[model samples]
Target: MLAVIQSSIREYPLKPQHLLPLALATVLIGCAPSPDEELNATLPQLSLKELLPQAVANEYCNPKLDSDLLYGIGYQLYNDDKPEQARSCLIMAAPTHDRALCYLASIAEQDSSKDSAERDRQAFGYMAYSAVKNDSCAEFGMFQNFTYGMRGQTPDIDLGLRWLERSARHGDADAQQTLVRLHSNKGNLPLAYSWAKVLDDQAQIDALKQRMNPQQLSEGEQGFEQLSKIVTSKDAVRKEAREENIAVYSANIHMEYPETFKGLSVAERHALMEQAVATVSARPEFSTRGQFYAYVIIAQQAQLKQTGVDVLQNPQIVELLSDTELEVSEAVKKADVILGQAAL
Candidate 1:
């Protein structure tokens, strides 16, 4: 599931001196508006669902459709700011679709009506349901609820800490980031370094390095090696791809080529290019957007060589390659290294 909470709702003052302050000073000047308030301001005057026909809604809730397809449709609808329609599709997918459940919980949490207590209860129930299925975001939500106390529940720090660790291990970025600070504040630099390394936060790694002596740094490195085996950035990459609509684009790729793309129409060729773009963008190995496009160019060239169909001839492909923002040569070299590793 996409990480629902960007900024934490409640800041746990575990070790105040060791806590990292907000980088932007202006954000601290006054009472900042809640995340819900910020979200409400940006929402469209009319929902996308309001414009669509009733048949579309019925189709989304169709029992004949695959759960994955239903969830994907719901995911797109939710991101497109049509929560009411999204909720219907999500409900159809239900308990089997854990990420859909998370999205539902997020939608419920945004309710500001007088019966919001009931909404909170429903939201908490959704998170609890998904958490047991090992959904990282749900696990993180459970950690937040248990640690801070919500929906008339009492705070239990010990239980919350356990959930936090579980969430981090499951590759929830927020939980890992929280652990980095918590461990650092508690003077466990090795554990802190392990998580920071997992996140590939160069600044945090560098800062942590400066604070450690040779022995501590060595131990941190050893800890990182061990931690990395269990936690990967792929989960983070997948979440990012979903939020950016890259997953939807990738899903459009037709892997089974009955005929060469060269024989296809202009629209089909454009779609082929989009598929190639999506493939590269969804990969975790590419470090930057420039690198992603560069790799796509390389991959497309390979495809042309193998199938004798020049997808790169498509206008969309040509336009993307023409952009000066891409660092082609260097990124291609790095991508080659990743390719070589996979080949081994």
Candidate 2:
């Protein structure tokens, strides 16, 4: 009945004499059959799928579908254990989608069965490159590669530091947290405290306190105070410090000083020890971006412990070790010895 009416409405002849009655009838009939009546109609009778395009065309202009919607659908498909279909959707969707590009990069770099570690590394490099082209968020993965030497990367500390700084300045909390760790490890307590202050959550602060000792936190606060004073002062030295020392002071310890603790001065060694302690404490507190915390801290501390004892006959470091604390693996011990001798 509605289709017939609609068809008559479309085909209704109009002449000068009938114009007024036609207009009146059209107004009384309204645009389509009643919506409620349509709801009571059977699926087989309505054939909604066939009519949907025409219905939409009648109601509005071309649809304003967003790239994000497609990406979301693609992500849903991916999470539904449909990788190939998800990949196809994402491929079609990514041309205008930055998040899709980032996801593609992650997927390419993450699919272990698709490639060897070396191949993945190369693939990640390309993805990182693509990500950077899109926006600042892409730097996150690039920094990851620098932190861990992959595919003969040889650990480019400078690149890692630069990328982290770039990402942090762009309001990335993960990058900010990383900078805090990096600065804290480098004994740049001022920077670490500054980063920590940005978190602005009481629970988070308490959790951080649980990870780091009061003494360390106090020292960091003092460092921040001192730095604040320096920046506030009009002194030439302050300018010089900002211009020159900030880079050295804020640099990541692990990347900048990758060497095992062999030739470090007593002061440097003590500072590093404090950093190691803080690092160990902070590791378990963060689970989201802190995935590698325990591994990195353990490896670094073990290396430092082994080399410090092997090189300077420093009973302090040796005394710091317990029988069960040191790794007794022959290869590790041999590497420690080599690092110790290299320092001398």
Candidate 3:
């Protein structure tokens, strides 16, 4: 055990005159909450009334201006028609919101007096940050700015398309619609059909079908073939299955000896799963992860017991399942073929 001497500098005696200032300094050094750098330095030194109107300061620091609460207050201010104040509040809460940076970029766009190039650069920086943080809306914002050059940057079609693709993958219907239009107008039917099929924009897809010859349609189907790999991955399937509260199975390693594995003849199931995994191992991307492939094969096997095998759509994928996109897709296709033949 240790005893500590609580002493101030000996030169500064314990005078009443010094007590208040020391207490104030303690508050400044310790209790004050300022997530913003500028405000952080000065707010602690100022009286509560001087820092903010007494009520506002009290509420801003109510429980404490924690990250979540600061975001809430800033979000509320934005909804209350106080966008300018909201910007200040949200800036202090930067990089965390229901996509606040995009909102800030929009607000910044209205400052017509700022130099156009500089203003666009500022907005672009905010949007780019938000996009990489996986804000679907910000990704879409980045897509537009890049595609059209509206933010003073030159049009970057390839980069814009990549952003747009990510935004669509994140389930922004608007981004999907843009992809549909872009691919359709460019006569890239296969890519367009992929987008259309995802969104179930059947009427337009049907119209496009009428114009395609068999080769064009076949080529179109193949063009977007690689895209579905994400959903078919073991991780995606497990997440979707868990969210739906579906039954999932354990692999041999996951359980010492699960009843399910025993019920299906452990040796046979393991052999079939390995065989299916071997088919995908032919692909380089998935060849390296042995155990991961086994987990995916187990997912494919689970689906086979019910109906068809689609590792991505398997409601019975194991909880701890993970696999590469290449492995998962190949596993599903190969497993379906293997299991389908076994059932027959």
Candidate 4:
């Protein structure tokens, strides 16, 4: 079964241009700029308040400043070693942004200034909120919180595993990877194979095959089929589409403006791109699903000198834009399919 799937999957091997020079790699890997230095170089010289206004701060889920931009800014600030600023922005974003809440939980957990009890309380609070919102990362965080026993909670391995499974079902790569290892370690080869198949970790799958008999492998294949449908359902597809859209847009922007992004870490670059996408998303003209697709298409065609006119010319885009009845999820699926085709 694994071999059959592997045969059909397209391999995207790394190209020569993808590799950094050995000297440059050494400098980046061993002697990268300090957080402060990176902050000064990459970010504009503006006060936090100027970048994020008090009015927006006061409003939870502010329409003027959307959650994505707030989270993006907060994420960048956190990466730049400015936890205080990150906390402020993340708090504002957390009402509607699960990832922001998860970040807040992490920030609280890592704060040396806080007492352990206080840290646990804050971390648990943020994680709980994010979990309610169905954020896979937060679900995984909750699993950790429960497994380790926080300030007000006792360790419950059963409950932790439940959360871990929930996170895996919600399409968290980390959670899926962890489940594969946990099950494999516990001699549950069938369960392990199911998750490994979902993750497309061919090496792990192959290793598990060596351990499992034919019956166990067949059961695993059945589990994989069931899990695939759940993970590839409409909600999951929309979640994946939104993430990929931001990632591709960000990568395109980085490619187009390498000088502006020089010396930035991958996380930092993605943070900046998130903010850029948020800004573009907030524009009135791009409010509709069709318009958003157009923006993404333009970004995708950055090196090709493709203009808005070219994007508008796309038949799928035209059809999508014309369909006023399409729900966001449907539109998202359509857009993702279009993007996948473009990639090919």
Candidate 5:
């Protein structure tokens, strides 16, 4: 019945006489719908997939222009596990929406096949374009690709640091946190504390403030409040990702393959560790992301324990054994020497 009325409405004549007859018929027959009702009734409660194009037509209308509606649809679709469809909305919005471009780049990176350098290049290009437009999320991504070399590139610490700083200035909490960790690691307590104050727990903030002079502490607090506005804004997709970093980043990173070298003899354990590291390091980009975290933290920790050394007392042992980027072969050799001496 709805379809028949819709067909009649679509095919209705354009003349005033025709509309007059329709109006009279609508008034005379109580069972019949007005033209507006016919059209509205045709619009059934369709799923997002069915409604998206119609919404695009209504809101976007032009193929060349970026649409906020399209950007939103793409973001939701991508989150909903529909990348193939999300690509459509995101690509349309990429002309103006940096977040959309970043998502497109990430999707390409995620969907790229083995030996697909062109695809990788395209993905990086998208990130570069988005980053140049001051997309904090894209800036952070580029920093990761260069710093960790986990996206088929060599690690360029200098370039990565520059981008990282840019990302932080743009109010990316991920970049801010990374900068804080890096500074603390390098013993640049002032710079670390300054940045950490902008992105830290109350305890960490208090500790950092204690390390600073009154003037520096005041400056740090002022800067923290200013950047905190950008960092905490819910509108930016990058901010959402930054909030998630606290819960998911460290927990999500794990060795691609198992480090099943435990319970084996020292030599056997050493060989297993070396093999795993070599295999992962040989790959330009990999699940391990250029880090041998599990081997050092878990497998090598066991060896250190067997030597009966207090891991807490020997800060040197902790420092030497805690490199994520250390080569597997080098790590095994170093561990044997250090743990062996500690046993004596």
Candidate 6:
């Protein structure tokens, strides 16, 4: 054991001063072990839930460990599917509210049962509302609003647009594109033009100009052609599935933020993206065709950026179409064929 000795350095000569050092020495020797070593030695005896709070208390009040540790613990709980526990861990870490809100939204979306869905929806709504207050990337808030009917508690296009616009203002490219699509479908040419202008590609802008009225576009025929190509394109399916999975998983991962990976640097972002793709790729529920659709959506987004229209006609888009585009179309064809066979 490490120990210290309390001896008087000054010559005493029977003086009263010598007694002062002697008295204090006895008291100092009694309590010498550092608090941390003692805690670490005893920690194994406690339950994980108990130990988690203890770790949080140490990290929060002791000022020894980095704050990122808080997020790490919260992420562990989240991945374990213990959202309530994860929430507490994150709260103690005091991570961003937006991350917490995203977690709440994910939990709601994952539940299929009606009663559970309602409870999850309410919980998600409260957090998403809080999240949207801080960041527009929290447009996941609009998704929640659309799905659950909060505020006035009825689905309203006006309210949806208000939220989407709020997200768009925050520089979300997705929201900007979504607005263009919605306006185009509604035959609001002026609104579509306004939103489409925000895109980086000039070609896409011109294509938006060529957009026929909703009535003129054959939903079934055009959609069928697109679907047929998706299934046949291997590269397209891989990219699409990977991206879609990443988006969904990233959204789920976002739910655990601040407490799970709050200060994540760019390197960490790429690692998590890779992990999310792997997780989605392994899921049997996500068929190859489904994966193809996911890629088609991505290719379409790329096309829309480069050409300004959802329907791609550019040479580059055409080249990508035969490659990724064909994969997506094939996937769609397979789905249609499967459905037809099932009906028979």
Tell me, by TM-score, which candidate is best. Answer: 1
Q: Can you give the lDDT of residue 344 in candidate 3?
A: 79
Q: Write the per-residue lDDT of candidate 2 for residues 1-344, one digit (tens) a residue.
A: 00011111121121222222232243346745432123123112322132112212111111232343345455655556655555555555555554454555555555666556654654454445444542335555555555455433556655555555545443455666665655555544445665566533355446556656667788656543533332222354334333222222212232223353346553654465545444434635323212222223334545555543322233433332322334434334544554465457
- For each candidate in turn, the TM-score is 0.59, 0.39, 0.45, 0.55, 0.45, 0.37
Q: Write the per-residue lDDT of candidate 3 for residues 1-344, one digit (tens) a residue.
A: 00111222122111222222333344346654411222123212322122122124332323234344455455555556666666665565563453656666775666577888867866766666666555667777766665667677677665566566666665666677776777666666666776776666889779878988888778656544544432133355344333212111222222222333444543555454455554544544343444354554555355548645555343333222334444444544555565456557
lDDT of 6 by residue, 1-344 (tens): 00111122122122222322332243345554422223223212322232123323432222332333444455556677876565555544433333434454454455455475575444445444443343444453553354346422455544445455545544555666665566555555545555566534467556765774554334323422432332123354356445434434443434422233345564665465565356445644444433534334433333333444332233433333335335554543443343344336
Error of 6 at 143 (Å): 4.9
Q: Residue 176's C-alpha lDDT in candidate 5?
A: 75
- What is the per-residue lDDT of model 1 for residues 1-344, given as tens digits with 9 covering 90 to 100? 45444353345545422222221122234346622233223222332233212324553446555454466677767788878777777776664566666787877777676387877776776776677666778778777777778644478765566677667767777888888877887777877887799878999999999999988888788767766655646766575445434433322222112123335554655565557566555645445555554645556544644555443444444444445565666545554454445346
TM-score attained by model 6: 0.37
lDDT of 4 by residue, 131-248 (tens): 6666778777766656666535677765566666667777777778877877776667788898899888999999999999999999889777766755535466465657655643
Q: Give me the displacement of residue 241 in model 2, in angstroms.
A: 37
- Candidate 5: count of backbone clashes, pairs at least 3 residues apart or interchain: 0
lDDT scores of the candidates, listed in order: 0.60, 0.43, 0.51, 0.59, 0.53, 0.43
Candidate with more favorable, higher lDDT: 2 or 4: 4
Residue 104 in model 5: lDDT: 73
285 Cα displacement, candidate 4 (Å):
30
Displacement of the residue 83 alpha carbon in candidate 2, Å: 2.3
lDDT of 1 at 68: 49
Q: What is the lDDT of residue 196 in candidate 3?
A: 73
Question: In candidate 2, what residue range of length 10 has the lowest lDDT sum?
Answer: 1-10
Clashing pairs in 2: none
Winner on TM-score between 2 and 5 is 5
**Model 2 regions lying over 4 Å from their true place:** 1-66, 112-114, 134-137, 202-344
Model 6 bad stretches (over 4 Å): 1-69, 72-85, 93-97, 108-118, 147-152, 201-203, 211-344
